[model samples]
Target: MFMVYVSETQPLVDFLRSIKNGSTVLMASYDEPATKLSEEARNLIAEMGSTYVKSLGFRDNWVFVGAKALPVKLCLFQHIKNNDKTNVYENWPEIIDMDGCIPKHME
Candidate 1:
């Protein structure tokens, strides 16, 4: 699953084009004027299909605006990290140190 935030159509199209078929995408943006699309964006997304649709309300800052969308076959784990680490990151039940790096399995 991929999470993306976009303001225009071409970038969204590029994002869709980059992903393989059967991939799932999660898209979010500030609620537009109830008429956000400029006809072209709507058409582009329509051609893309509902398998890639996910509209959301406004967020203070978009965390990942241009990352490649993820494949649907794999499960995805994603969350917004708190800008200030005085508290825990939003996705965590346990605490994460601000400057800690653990070894990855691939490494």
Candidate 2:
């Protein structure tokens, strides 16, 4: 598998839908100001995520959408042609290897 990081999902939806099974995508990283989000905006974002995920359906393909925090914007995409899939967390050792910061969730 290989990876791609995107800030917005709409632009990559087409390309993502065309990828073979066992692929993974990382999107919508939550940053420092995430705490400033209003409850209404959070609800809207959540709804949008569900819609985006449903639009791109591949049985074995996986997509990780997040409002989670990362060292930067939380985005990672894994490209797998056949069945060579790996745990999403395993893809980035640096997250675990960091001095004090541990990523709570991938998405």
Choose the strongest candidate by lDDT.
Answer: 1
Stretches > 4 Å off in candidate 1: 1-8, 47-107
Per-candidate alpha-carbon RMSD to the true structure: 10.4, 16.4
Q: Write the per-residue lDDT of candidate 1 for residues 1-107, one digit (tens) a residue.
A: 22233355566556566766444434333323113344454444434343222331223221111222323222222223223443243522223223223222220
Error of 1 at 85 (Å): 38
Instruction: State residue 53's C-alpha deviation in candidate 2, in Å.
Output: 14
For candidate 1, give the lDDT of residue 67: 23
Q: What is the lDDT of residue 6 in candidate 1?
A: 35
Candidate 2 C-alpha lDDT tens digits along 8-79: 333334444454433232333221113333344334333333233333222223334433223344333322
Q: Give the TM-score of candidate 1.
A: 0.30
Superposed by TM-score, candidate 1 places the C-alpha of residue 42 at a distance from the truth, in angstroms, of 2.0
- Model 2 pairs whose backbones collide: 2-78, 2-79, 3-77, 4-77
